[model samples]
Target: MSTTETHHALWVAYGASGVVGTIRKSDEGYTVTMAGADAAAGTYPTMEIAKGALHSHMTPGSDWPQFREH
Candidate 1:
């Protein structure tokens, strides 16, 4: 038997600095796309969960890491 799949695309994050993200609905869970960093970061049971992860990564720290590791 041939199996079928459904795809649901959602624009979750968008704002200044050209930072954007998307959340796609899947049979298993949801997927998030934050900038060009991570395509398929991971699969979460819920959109909220996935969003939390995305936000964590998207949020920059107090300062950027130094170019030299030291």
Candidate 2:
């Protein structure tokens, strides 16, 4: 079960870098935002699914490609 309780915008970013993705709740359901677009990613029936959709976009891990330090 899910609650209608509203939530502030949820975002995932890396350090000073910009956001990788976001999750928002609406009357319909939770929405995923990425690449600077709305509903660009996917919609979820539950906040948990929406959160899982964020994946590494919010989490910091080696999944992202490695680059040499400047």
Candidate 3:
């Protein structure tokens, strides 16, 4: 018997006013575009961070920890 697996790719971006952006790959690399801005492109090893950035951007009203210790 044989088995197969599948993986998906994703793209993410954050804008000046906490605008979130995302794109999914049809084959490999992902694409992104911001509000009335030129499209920027890139690739990633995985989709975790890409998704995270989208969430972070959408929830700008929330508080984030600031690091003081080194």
Candidate 4:
């Protein structure tokens, strides 16, 4: 018999208005999706890059917080 473990990596970013965006670990890379968006903004090879992408996608003046594992 063999055992397999699965991991679902997820990170959330919050702002003054509430949930701002999220980064989900995918096979290709980290996928960043902004709030109320119809599709993902983009995908990055690393979490750091993904966070940066999410921040850049945020609207001006939005109070975004550090990404937290969720």
Candidate 5:
């Protein structure tokens, strides 16, 4: 079984650009913010959806990186 734990934030990296975005957990939900952004792109109810949102928000034609949770 998977244990539930507190997750604050996670960094996203793709290709040669390391740490391109972030997924932050809040009371409302998970928020995805790209690097150099003033505000979050959006919030999702689940981390899976948040991950998908991050992937969708990325630049077109880019390969998906192997996401590692911290």
Candidate 6:
């Protein structure tokens, strides 16, 4: 059998540069800001898609460094 873990994340698209802001739940829906700006409050159907959208808006070199360093 497989076990599933539930996570909640929020993502924001900041302007033309395509920068992304990500916020997520840590332990039991406790608010946790991952490694970016605080995104506007919203809900996504799945955590994977939400994370994918946040990654898609990365500004190449700059965003990668921030993501890696954190």
Residue-pair clashes per prediction, in order, are: 0, 0, 0, 0, 0, 0
| Deviating ranges (above 4 Å) for candidate 3 | 1-19, 52-70
* Model 1's TM-score against the true structure: 0.60
| Candidate 3: C-alpha lDDT | 0.43
Q: Rank the candidates by TM-score, best first.
A: 4, 5, 1, 2, 3, 6
Q: Show model 1 residue runs off by greater than 4 Å.
A: 1-7, 61-70
Q: Evaluate model 5: give its lDDT.
A: 0.77
Relative to the unseen true structure, what is the C-alpha lDDT of residue 65 in candidate 5, on a scale of 0 to 100?
51
RMSD of 6: 8.2
lDDT of each: 0.61, 0.56, 0.43, 0.86, 0.77, 0.43
- For model 3, how does the per-residue alpha-carbon lDDT over 42-68 read when each residue is reduced to its tens digit? 433345543443345444674432211
Candidate 5: give its CA RMSD in angstroms.
4.6
Tens-digit lDDT string for candidate 5 (1-70): 8998764776564544676678877778988887788999999999889888888877787677556666
Least accurate stretch of 10 residues (summed lDDT) in model 5?
A: 7-16
Report the poorest 10 consecutive residues by lDDT, candidate 2: 61-70
TM-score of 2: 0.50
Candidate 4 per-residue lDDT over residues 1-70, each given as its tens digit: 9997666699999877788999999778999999899999998999889988898888876665677898
**Can you give the lDDT of residue 14 in candidate 2?**
26
Q: Residue by residue across 1-70, what tens digits does model 6's lDDT show?
A: 9998875444433434543455354443323233354643434445555455555545554443122112
Query: What overall lDDT, based on C-alpha atoms, would model 1 receive against the true structure?
Result: 0.61
Best by lDDT: 4
Q: Lowest summed-lDDT stretch of 10 residues in model 1?
A: 61-70
